[model samples]
Target: MLKINDITNASSAGAFVVKKGFGAILAVTCLLGAACSSQSVEEGGLQPVALKEAATSASTQNVADKPNVLVLMFDDMRFDTFSYRGGPVPTPNIDALAAQSTRFDMAMTTTGLCSPSRAAFFTGRWGHRTGLDDNVALWHSRQTGLKDEEGGIIKRASDAGYYVGYVGKWHLGPNGMAKRGAEFVDTYKKELEEHERQGAPYGRMAQTKRYLAGERDENGEKNQYYLTLKGDYDDTQAAQKVRAGQEMIKSAAKEDRPFFGVISFSQPHPPYRVPEPYASMFPVDEIDEPANYMAKRVNKPLSQEIPWWPWHEVSHMTDNDWRESRAHYYGAIAMLDRAVGEIIQTAKDEGMWDDLHIVFIGDQGSMIGEHGLYDKSAYAYDELMRIPLLVRDPDVEPRVVNRIVSLMDVPVTMAEWMDLKPDGAVDGDSLTPLMLKGDSAITDAEDDALYAYEWYNGAWFGLRAIRTQDYKYVWNPGDERDELYDLKNDPGEIVNQIDNPDYKAKLLSLRKRLELRLVEVEDSSVTRLQRLIELNS
Candidate 1:
């Protein structure tokens, strides 16, 4: 599905390359990707030179050196409890990192939150080039970072030499992520504020007594509400982000370089805590509901028919509080699949898993209660916008690419798998030719709509979306009832049919394709969807 055909002919050579439909050149090269900072130098960062490849397809184009990336990420994970959804959560280290990976069955995360999708996965740009719905005002935006006229992805993977380790949650800008690449980094916020001032992240309620049962404090030592046993797995927080991803993969394999690590985990988010055979492993009537659980509509808006606190208290929850928050959200995804199986068994005990290019993502995706919602706002439901992309690229092989992709294509698919070329025009465009032509017509199979944006919960949380794999078009320019969904017969977006009448011409052709993708991302919410189409025509 790589056919953006040079983003409208590289937006007339001002530059925006990588053609062949990654959601129509990610809104036409991020809408003329800021005219490649005034072009000229061979029209800015070239080297895509075309490919429709025929000579027996499959190729990563004669693999060029550079393959030592890690990137785990994972915060509010969703995609129905991964190991690719054989749910009842028990990830076995993300199903052994999705068994030699490439999993992505329709991924997404344009904006689900956590500093606007990790500032569009480290600056491939989105969320109005990282500003709206602020993540510390997009870590003080210079267009979501690495600015000196751009060269993100950790300053072009530390100026193409690699060795760039950034550990745990930086919520977008820890002083512009301590100026990008450091041979080693840490944003654990003072070890999570001294593990929440020694309450040890409320020790998941000492394995659920539901607060205050042997919970100590006031000059108390051992005040972390008691470790939720199951052998208090190193007092969890995904085991201190897997021991800071095993000390940054043993200090980047004793400084032999070629590293890129990024670990980052906060866990199945929220105080859901885990550890203890994954907090007594799943069983709340076998955790399965969400066909928009407790679904409702009435033209849903007003922050979705009043869903806020505990999803407006999900009808006084019980079934053991939704099976104890879905067994502590699959025991925080089996305590983050046992800290992603000790950071891939410390990168397969430092022999660095084959060629090691690992990348299991998820900066967003969660609506735990769905419809009766709860957290993650600026709605664009698909369980708070799909995310669970696993790519193992040791020159590709393992398959399954239902392709919808976009977590702003993870740093231009890591600057096109280290062939590095980051300088200007960046509005994402690289899945390495749809992960080397794996399947599902990855791009232009025409879901010709995949934008996402939402103000950081204010001015009525202005939202804007344009998903399309069978319809979804949110547009709450400060609420007035604007949403439509049909995701092939409601993929749990539980009915909002935008003033339905057999979907008034698919809601004005998805509001004129979301006003031409919010006018190629220079956006403004198209005059609030044209004032509800001139006050309802």
Candidate 2:
């Protein structure tokens, strides 16, 4: 464990240093105290038995004795968008939850796009296995020859005598639509058409119900957004979905079986539109652009092909346009925070808070103009790959972990908590060890690297990236362009150090590590990229 004094000393000597001011020294001391306290709790104070021994004993307990599960997923939300993380946006409700939960500083999604990453969560399988590696509309389960598989954590809970219900954002497939309550498909289709005619983006329940009914826009648009403009926050599509989740929780409480419900919200995504009160939550002048918001896509792979949009080119937008857009995005996030608070409060009201294990995470992160990208999928930047993951387990230590953990580990961890049989073939390991140990066996250097790929567009492209504490390396096989950044020296990832011969050995070693990981994971598609590199060689 690195001490706070050690961190302060290193920071003072490093390029990014915190000055030895009274405030800075005080902050450092406080941080060190917290870290030391957490370490002590994990060492022995939290449990009488050894951490490993306790985990084994807990796992032996049956599902009926296990804690109830509530998994909430937010859409297009970035890792640092909450006020708790010093983000400009205010999310008091989420911040409150963080105070009581264990927050992960490094949680990544396997894929940065919506559908593919979402499928990964539901199936507890990689995007390749789920056949949802891309976000193309034509790639529905039926069209892809995919079958409804019971592989999500929900299935494990259901098998453990828990009533499972999923609410909001069923991007995995249409399987959840009928479960959402719909008698006639045509009725939903008609409702959507009516909403479209009225120029109202599909309100929450209306849009989800319509999508489940297999409704499409007259123009043959693929996503639900096409049928209805981005809905407003109050009466918007996302809020309605959240309301449905609240109702489901209330209903589940009435049932005899302990319940596991997923509340997924779609917001802070494209069609950036929010309704009243929330829409005006943030003033225009207060919206601050990202530090690297103006970065150009020069000599970069994948990103060079993407066009510059308002998110990246906010400077080009008129004052009014920029304010309205930023306001809406922030408001949407506020709406999500409120919904989460309601859910948490509901659990308390229903007497389930103490006995329940809740997890909150985003499918993948979105870039709100960071590195000049808007929605994810084009690049593997931290803003797109890194997501927020919060876990609240009464049996585990409550502390923040800076170690890297992937979304792939969520299902296995949930299975362990629920005392259900785990599908052993998962690429991700259960994070229960970290939850109990307050540190990971894998060092920061070992856990720094992550893999992201996109098979969309005209070609199959792969980006192998390794993000160390002080540097980042991006290997693009298709373009044969490698990017390296000394993150310690340039936190903005502005300058590429790949051409610098001084770091040749380090780059080669990291590249080899990335390749080894691909092989270990049996990432066939990524391996294909390696083959292409070999063929070119």
Top-TM-score candidate index: 2
Give candidate 1's error at residue 381 in angstroms.
Answer: 2.4
1-537 per-residue lDDT for model 1 (tens digits): 211122123222222111000000101001000112111111112211111111112122333345777777766677767655777765676676677777777877777766667766776776564453443322112222223333367767666666666555544432343355454554432211211111111222232332224333233212111113333566443454466557767766665446676766555554354446665666556667756665665567776554332223344444455556656666666666666766677777867677777777777766656666644666788877887777777657778777577777768877776667666546666676666777544545345446565544232366777787788888776776778889898787777888779889878877777777666666666776777666655
Per-residue error for 517 in candidate 2, Å, reads 1.5
Our tally of clashes for model 1 stands at 10
Instruction: Give the per-residue lDDT of model 2 (tens digit) for 1-537.
Output: 101111121111111100000000000000000000111100111100000000011122244444567777776677887898887777887898777677887887777766566666655676555655654232111222123453555555555666565544444333332332211111011111111111111233343454456554344331212112232333444444444556656666665555566655545554354445665678768777766774776667755554322123223334344445556667667767776776677777766776567677877766655564545555667777788888777766678888878887777777666666664356677777788786665676567646566554223556666666666777776676788888777777777777788887777667766777677667675666566446533
Q: Give model 1's TM-score versus the native structure.
A: 0.33
lDDT at residue 45 of model 2 (Cα atoms): 11
- The deviation in Å at residue 257 for candidate 1 is 6.9
